[model samples]
Target: MKTLTLAATAILLTAGFASAQTVRIGTEGAYPPYNMINDAGEVDGYERELGDELCKRAELDCTWVKNDWDSIIPNLVSGNYDAIMAGMAINEERQKVIQFTQNYVPPQASAYAAMSADADVEGGVVAAQTGTIQASHVAETGATLVEFATPDETLAAVRNGEADAVFADKEYLVPHVEESNGELVWIGEDIALDEGIGVGLRQSDTELKDKFDAAIASMKEDGSLNEMIGKWFGEGAPLFE
Candidate 1:
């Protein structure tokens, strides 16, 4: 996308932060078009590209580290990684535990997918990834919320009749439904929650947070961030701009 100006690159180099030399970005490598393990067994996808660009613009040596979605935050708190670029949403509850860079991706619609078009979306068993906004929403609907550690498991639960439907980010579920042909179909209205998606850093790492925030801001200003979103999520995908 956008190339860093010489002046901006020089400023990042002179920022004098130790973490600037080797920042490890943690992510759930199971989410496609966001983050995924490629055939070569390495982290690959949208966040991979976006994270690399941010690191380059900030002049930081960086690498990717894969972690399960459920324990991603805990691992970051425990110093397993320096930052999270895992398509994590920014909300008040998460903000209580860690700091976030300004949102790089805008809030997206969450939806439900089921084996049949008439499947019950309310007051029925529902599957969702543990520790996610969709899980919380399903719980509040008086539905039996079956929590899974991963997104794929939620879809499996529905396919196997363990749950009537799966609630998740619409983008993440779209491909699964397409691949399933007519076996799976989207049901119910779209749910919108959280402000947007952002990079997460420990509360104590203000310098690292600032560095990434500036990098994200620069991408937004140069239209590179929107370009990346379109490339990965399709032309009609929502953008930060």
Candidate 2:
């Protein structure tokens, strides 16, 4: 009986070791609706659901890892994680550093929010999450750009009068505006940029990228992706299809 127990233990250990090699899905857990740390302190939200489905379809064992938004791309390149599904937009500049799966979410409108309806969106001081496309856009425009390490900080900056306006994804800003009662208001036209959101992978991880791409394509064809989008972002949300 002792010998039989030892053999079973060895097998179990081997299986556990293999399972530890799960593909790591990196994300910024701070971004709500897209991705966030739930009450249980695990990664949850739209990207969480979407990414899990893609991994299942691809037949890949996966796990989630949280990282700061500013270092997301760099950490992916450094092999800290196998892929990035943290609501990242696919753009030319990012493509130069790493490959991207086909966009799972379509191009989204970037918008500005301010404390007052008459705030100078184009010429006033604007706050944006550091290292994001919105920050880049603000830097190029006539507005003065103040960058924060996290999304919450950018919104806080506008609320505290450090910035006249805050620029970010329209969808992300919506909840804040709604919760603010009359304190916050959407201002300025939507700024459209990039192709869409996709999973970021290292340049050499074409196999992994292809798997995710195929999974995303499958979700689009079957309408499950669209359903998930609506479930998280409302029925009027933009979808890949």
**Per-residue alpha-carbon lDDT of model 2 for 1-241, expressed as tens digits?**
0112433423433332233247999999998899999999999999999988887766678999999999999999998998999989988889999999888888999999999999997899999999899999999999999999999999999988999999999989989998998899989688898788999999998767656766677677668889998999997788763
Please write out the lDDT profile of model 1 over residues 73-188, one tens digit for every residue: 99999999999988888988899999998888888889999998988888889999999888888888978899999999999999999999999988889889988978999897
Find the candidate with the highest TM-score and give its number: 1
Q: Any runs in candidate 1 off by more than 4 Å, and if so which?
A: 1-20
- List residue ranges in candidate 2 displaced over 4 A: 1-21
User: Each model's TM-score, in the order given?
Assistant: 0.92, 0.90
CA lDDT, every model vs. true structure? 0.88, 0.86
- Clashing residue pairs, candidate 1? none
Worst 10-residue lDDT window, candidate 1: 1-10
